[model samples]
Target chain A: MEIGAEAIVQNQTPKRAAVTTGADRPGRRPSSGRFRRLNVLVGVLSIPLFIILWELTSRSGIVNMVLFPPPTVVAAAVLEWMRSGQFFWDVAASLYRVTAGFLLGSALGVLLGILTGQFPVVSSLLSPLFQILRPIPPIAFVPIVILWFGLSEAGKLFLVVWGVFFTVWLSTHIGVQKVDRGLIRAALMLGTPRRQMLQEIILLGALPYIVVGLRTAVSISFYTLVAAELAGTFAGVVYRIEIAQQNLQTGQVMGGLAALGLISFIADRLFAALAERTVWWR
Target chain B: MSGYRSTTKLALASSQPSVKTVSEQPAIQVSNLSIVFDTNRGQMIAVDRVSFDVAAGEFVCIVGPSGCGKSTVLNTIAGLEVPFEGEILVEGSPVGHPRPDIGMVFQQPHLFPWKSVRRNIAHGPRMLGKSAKEAGAIADDLIAMIGLKRFADAYPNTLSGGMQQRVAIARALANEPRVLLMDEPFGALDAQTRAVMQDNLLELRDRIKATIVFVTHDIDEAIVLADRVLIMSAGPGRILREIAVNLPRPRSSAILIEPTYLALKRDCLEVIRAEGLRAFNQSDSS
Candidate 1:
């Protein structure tokens, strides 16, 4: 009886395999493979195709060449800016402002977030005030910041810091509050002291959210950097963009915009890589 | 077996002296333990004056249907539940806060996702101010006991459910608590894995010798693992009956097929079915 059952099973196996392979091969597999290859080809051509179209549009006089510079003209302008040594100084100044403001803002935000998230009294005292101020755009503070600091570096720092602070603070606050109560209870049962509870359990538990907040603050820092430099700056990429716009050096303006985009893109990618490392478990 | 005992001894040396003095007292005492929760409707009684004692080194299982507050009672003993009207003493002291002497394994394992198996097991010792080296040594011993030495450096997410729960059990044991409370630790696993884990736990229990109060709804599981099974009724939960298991030790889930085990299970199910029918009829009439 067992040998007969085994013989029947062996006979049935090839038929099922043949049926599946026959179905998969003729219609499904090759078409899907071809479609996937087409997708890859299209993705690879995407940016170059856009650049060629942009170049043709500018040269064809569909738009003013001066205002809508060709990619070649933008590239030339970027090269010229680099050759003049101003590009290095502009990048340095912008980097300094963003890094300093981001560090100070995120530090304060995390400290206050832990305080407000952990203690109801602290939340009651500061949360209402923070909620009121958080909705107002940091760019709106440009005028007030200029009046307070009068074109000094401090005014620029203040604007960027303001922009970065709220996002980090809100996310951190929510993250801390959302930490698994089970984890806290488990930690408590294991005899974790109050201080160690915060440092080891609460902080680490909320870290993924905190990292997300900091990444968002990275972009917010860039956005505020634009507003700050446009308000007033001695040397920065946005300042150079403004100068180029006034002079009708449209190519240079476009180049500066491209430079800013590239820098922000790099910053975001860097932050994303750092975020993966920050929340290593995920 | 000898290596396991000595390692446990060295790890528990600090607390060993206190154990002898309190040997006569029950490891856990819950007297008139009533817990009420304020739901949206009104004050709902989760546990209604339920009381029990687990003697030193005894294995007790609280079996009940869902919402019967078996877990709440276990949590109360672990000091994770509060604002209850009653008294609880662990190792002869009134339980209010979670003491290091009482370790709990929650249903979901609740292993720290960020830490490796070894590090997760090491956490309790580290929290109690043992040096890093001491904690690592303690964790390694548990890692071997649980038979997860190969996965010691693995993160919680990488392990299978049974393995993760094993690590959680090991982590709870790291502190060498006098009382170990488990709240349906195997409830979430598949049937095959759950049976294996039950057998593994029975084996581990012999060596650990900690007073264990396990809460579960599985009758077969309770009969397989416990020295005494407390059957609880739902809706303003209270203990319906207590059945003592006279099953021999060095037992496995294989004994689940034994005539004696089936008899004990039948007694539990009868009490549960009677209460369940009464509850259903009363609700239907209302």
Candidate 2:
């Protein structure tokens, strides 16, 4: 237990350089202490500072309060939307589309990526097609999607999935290809058979890249969700924003945007934490 | 089984009338092997008709200059590289792919980063269909032999370079390979650590029954560990000479300071210097 615990502690120190170095360095000075304190203070005050500037400008006869609503108006509008229970439905609808699309798209992307990456024949057949299709923006498909599926939920899912698939696919393909040949040779010398080679060596080797691709796809999923709901949706955060914008309810529009930003920010942070655990050896 | 094998051989000999080299039954054989590479400047010969044999349980070192294909020859024996011509036979079977009975340790430790020391060592046995408990038992034995008992559960990144290489050697031996191919396993270490590892390997070799074929450019390393040294020349690698080190068994790094050791080193250096001058003169004339 001592050895195991000691090893774990040693392994953790270098890994936590970002958090440890700021506190652990020996050359701490009084002026540097003040500078660090100032940095923390600024970080805490950042949102408030921006909100205060917006409020001052809106009320100081510099801008129309209705058109350029401040933080208080946006907060009040969000509260009202929550009270009406429409916020819950909007959030749920948007979340469902993003989650479902991400999972399906990520699954297909990983499958196809491994196929193309590991097998040259499959790569020769499909990579050129994926390359041609990848650059076309998902939003450009919105008009054609309406023609094909007529504002259905499937069309929305398609848009979100399309947004996510190519990124994960390409990253996975590259990751698989980039798996260290040294590791592969080492494994083969250990009597690993062909099929087991993929499972025991290739998958874990490429996982870091796949996790990175998935993280990028997280933001992409959100981007495409907005396009999907804006094209047409009965209830979604972006759909609510569209309706509020049409009615000149700039406060709700701003509130919806803020909510979207907050969600995306939390999601990114959560995935970053998960990514740390995924490639824990790093 | 021997009777049946001889009968089959007799039948095959009668049917084809093939030429068979009747010689000592060696553990590993590389006869007239050649490896060519397709370069930007057309085809280049990497190893040209190089041949050698290792008797059962013998430790052999192949020493040469950088780019002399010493590592290529070792890889061919490990079935990691295909010879352009000629064949490599290990344990009387034609070498084609990496077999469980063959183990290898590369210059870089190349430990699986995610695995603990024990798991890394256990991987060979586990891949060969040993149960988890059985593999663990085997790994623990090697861990003890390598003197890394305390760090059994340590990930590769936490260990020092020499420690990692010790683990690599242990991992390779978990399958009890008959022939172990080492390509500069200690080359990356500092002088002190390298000396320590060499001593450690000498001690470990006395206990294991594996035949070892080690490749190194270091002349002292070749003499200290190997029962026989195969000196190779560069630019289309060819065996220049063979020197058998008659040093007593159970030797240590301390033996490297002996007068006999110096004489052997001088002999090896003389051969290499002569080969170098020849290559240099050839290049100058060209």
Candidate 3:
């Protein structure tokens, strides 16, 4: 890639600003621009470096190619999976599970969180239940889920929902609790009608935290998906990985891991993009 | 300056003898008002026995120390807080709960983040059974009057603090309320912005010909904006003294530098100063 001189000049105004200020101004736009650029460069360079090291290790026989496989082999397997439509099916299945689970869990979480956060009586009543159950991991609930719903997609979905619920619920509850008292007072003094008070002041005040929780919930969905798949079904990418490990196809196992990582990254990026667009006011 | 000039023009035009006959009724009447809040320990008197009548089209400022319950008085009048004693009668009827006829502004702008400036301003009008067309017109007029026409569509976050408060003022006026209750509405702003907002408020008050009960801790602010300044004592907050600021109509920022303005400020300070000293002595002893 040829670097344009104007592009370099555009970038180097920071070089001018840096020499001018004795120390960089913190959190200011132009001052942070340099660090942002550096982070992007570091991120872009990481994959290539990993691939090069893998190829070098394969060629030098430092690691057996048959055991670990090179990046090219993994890429080829990914391409074959895509060609066979198995990759799309697996991705679609994972996406559906995450979407259904997160939406169901977060909807319930927000409603309960808002109710608890607003009224002290409600909070006290629910806090005990949350405290007791919150310590039990969603993975631990897999047995109960299976017992209740059978060892099927329903059980897997239940596990994922349970995993995401507490995360979103706690964040929203804390958010509503910590809403700026001044803002609430302002609304009340303005003679805001009672019914609209929660919707306008409380919920909107808690929105930024809810969004952060929603972002965190995506990670929880992936966590629960892999765990539930590993424990329950004889299908899903995790199941395929388990089967591959049993048959001693290490490359196929790594391939499954790569798919999981890709799905998580893409989903997170999409969610973050939505949040940035939606909650710019915060 | 343009703001006050327009207000003067409106006042002149609306000061017809027939107009006084048409709207001679008092906007708000607070008779024997007192507020006591029940905290965890016991009943705490926030506002002690107080009574005042705000005539239609008068600007009143209640000034005191930080904990003097100036805000409690405003909240009581607004019907947000129930007073332990006394009646706040608006237009000859007691205020039992919040009504659309009363508008309030607070220290924080409190503009809803989800709504644009225009939408926030239009909220009260729309809530009061006005059509979108009517609400939009009122919102537009208020926005223009507050000098925020250019920022009508902007979200609250995009605006400066002063601009956000301007939107808040516009929002309050949209209700076409008979009275405006403000509780340290400009106290949160920087000194420069606060000064500008004070000017804007006084100008708006003059133009609207609406009764305003403004609460603030700053004596200079009280003298600058008030037609009558009421000084309050702390702890079981009670009105200590009331002074009619007899400065000429359409006062400006330059009025603050006048000897009379300074004298009035000192008098108001003396009232709050005694309370301040007593508070400090109590704290020191404790």
TM-score of chain A of 2: 0.89
Better model by DockQ: candidate 1 vs candidate 2: 1
lDDT of 1 by residue, B1-286 (tens): 1255555554564344322333667888889999999999999999999988888888899999999999989888888887899899888899878989999999999999999999999999999999999999999989888888889999999888889999999999999999999999999987877887887787677668688999999998898989889999998999999998888766888898899888888898889899999999999999
Give the TM-scores of the predictions, in the order they appear: 0.92, 0.91, 0.87
Which one is best on DockQ?
1
A140-188, model 3: which lDDT tens digit per residue?
8877777898778888888888888888889899999988876665565
| Best prediction by TM-score | 1
Sliding window of 10 residues with minimal summed lDDT for model 3 chain B: B13-22
What DockQ results for candidate 3? Answer: 0.26
Candidate 1 per-residue lDDT over residues A202-276, each given as its tens digit: 999889889999999999999999999999879999999999999999999999999999999999999999899
Q: What digit string (tens of lDDT, one per residue) describes model 2 on residues A188-212?
A: 9999887998988899999999999
True contacts kept of each: 0.79, 0.71, 0.31
Task: Report lDDT (CA) for all predictions.
Answer: 0.90, 0.90, 0.81
Q: Write the per-residue lDDT of candidate 3 for residues B146-207, one digit (tens) a residue.
A: 87777888999988778888898888888888888898988888777788788777767656
Model 2, B50-111: lDDT tens digits are 98888877889999999999998888888888646898889999997899999999999889
Candidate 1, superposed: residue stretches over 4 Å from native: A1-25, B1-23
DockQ for each numbered candidate: 0.47, 0.36, 0.26
Which pairs clash in model 2?
A: none
